[model samples]
Target: MTRIEQTFITLKQQNKKALIPYIMAGDPNPSVTVDLMHKLVAHGADIIEVGLPFSDPMADGQVIATAGERALAGGTSTRQAIEMVKQFRQTDQNTPVLVMGYLNPIEIIGYENFANLCSEAGVDGILMVDLPPNEADDFPKKLQHYTPCPMNQIFLLSPTTAFDRRQSVIDNASGFIYYVSVKGVTGSNALDTDDVSTHLKAIKANTDIPVCVGFGIRDGVSAKALSAVADGVIVGSELVRHFGDDSIDTKTAIDNILAKMDELRRAIDG
Candidate 1:
């Protein structure tokens, strides 16, 4: 089984749901990225979704957009993002780290070469927000060229997705499928629990793999409500908000983030 699959299985055995958090790789500063990753695992994150800091992140809101701008201004590159994962793997061999971003960078590096580099760097999964399954016809085949495919090519599904399109994504997606709870960008308004539950029911009916819900999930209450219905919750803007405060140091930011994560961890486990 993939590391992500094993992580979910282990969580299922414990009667606990996964709490996956997202952060831009070089936000605040590139030097602190690996340390922040360790802190996430230390707190309670089951999987860490690290953003690749693209020039334009269409799916992200202002908070994340600002974080990406900070990262880029600090000279963060795709290679450095992979190296962060390599450094993270030094002490952590189990926690799954999924790199998320747009497709332009992947194409620039050449997909096969990028896969090889990720394999060498010990990355566990990747989520290209803009690369729908239709355009990624050969993505998995290319990834297989590596002796042992080092990453799961995760895909996104939204509330408006038709049944057939949902089925298409579920069939093609590995690791777990990311369900965008809201129809908009990250860090939007409050989530409607009843509406999300209905969507979760439909998605779970179609796929055996874990389905993680993201977008508009902000606090422990919302996290708990969603976790009760879905296999996991991927929180981005709420966590990224802490990192954007220039008034605080990176360690202070991470400590605060972990405290928030602790709340989420408790909520999901409850």
Candidate 2:
């Protein structure tokens, strides 16, 4: 089984929800990505989603978009992000590492080549925000051809998604379904837990695959509330915001990020 699948299965057995944290690879600099990933794992992150820097990230809010800009300015590329994952794999063989990004860079490198790179780098999953399941008929085949184990082709579902499209996404999804808790971009505020719970009921009725909620989750309260309904909680913008404060030193910035992670972990576990 893929690392992601194993993780969820293990968590289920433990009666615990997964805490998935996101970090922009090469944010501030390329050298810190691997270290930051390790720190995140140490701080109770079950899965790590590493953002590949892109010039245009439509789904991201201002916080994450600015992070991408910082990473791109530091000369971070798709290859660099993949290499960081390879470095991270040297010590962390258990925690699943997923690369989240747009499809432009993959297209530039060719899908087959990208699949090979991710497989060799020990990447567990890929979440291309713009690639719909209907349009990606051959992408999973390419990943399976290169990867010895199954590589998760993660997909997103939002409140605005039509039933037909939601079904198609769930049918094609492999690792887990990323349910956008709000109808806006990442980091937007005002999460309605009741609405999220209602939607999650409909989704869980259809599939046994783990469903993770993201977007608009900022703290332990929100994370804990969502954990009641979701198999996992994904925190991106709030965590990423801690990393982008230029005034703070890298060590201090990372400490702040881990502090936030710790808060979320405690709340979820409770």
Candidate 3:
């Protein structure tokens, strides 16, 4: 099984939910990516979603958009992002690492080559925001060439997903499914737990695969409420905000980030 798959299974066994945190690669600066990644694992992150710096990110809100821009401006390339993951693997061999970003950079390197690079970098999965399951027919074949073992081809499910499309996603998807809790871009809105629970119930009825809620989960209260229904909660903007502005010392920023992670962790596990 892939590390992601194993993680969910293990969490299920322990009756504990997963805490997945998202951060932009090279954000704030390129020098801190690896250290921050390690810090994430240290602070109870079950899985880490590392965003590849992209020039154009349609689904991202201003917060994540700015983070990506910072990474790009700092000379963080796709290769450099993968290198950060490789360095992270030196100490962390268990926590699953997922690359979350647009497809442009991966296509530039060729699909097969990108899969190989991810494997070499110890990455366990990918969530390409713009790539739909139907359009990714050839990707699995290419991925198999490099990854003989299972690797998550994670997909997104939103409130607007039709029955057929939802089935298609569940049929094609591996690992846990990412359910966007809100209709808008990341960091643009707040979550309604009742609505989230209703939607999550419908999704759980369709597939046995674990469901994870993201995009509007920003704090302990929201994370805990969502985790009661879903297998995991993904915190993006809120965690990214902990890094603060350039003026904040890197050490202080990191401490704040870890403190937030620990807070969310306790909420989920409580």
The candidate maximizing TM-score is 2
Winner by lDDT between candidate 2 and candidate 1: 2
* Local distance difference test scores for all models: 0.87, 0.91, 0.88
Which candidate leads the pack in lDDT?
2
Residue 111 lDDT (model 1): 83
List TM-score per model, in order: 0.96, 0.97, 0.96
Query: Stretches of candidate 3 above 4 Å error?
Result: 141-145, 148-150, 244-247
Please provide, for model 2 over 107-136, each residue's C-alpha lDDT reduced to its tens digit, 9 standing for 90 to 100: 999888888889999999999999999999
* Candidate 2 Cα errors over 4 Å, as ranges: 141-145
Which candidate order results from sorting by lDDT in descending order?
A: 2, 3, 1
Note the clash tally of each candidate. Answer: 0, 0, 0
Q: Per-residue lDDT for 1-270 in model 1, tens only?
A: 567878989999998889999999899889989988998898999999999988889999999999999999999999899899989988998999889988899899988788888878878787898888877887854553454535688989998888788888988888899999988899988578889899889888877889999999888999999999999999999999988888998778888898999999999888
Better of 2 and 3 by lDDT: 2
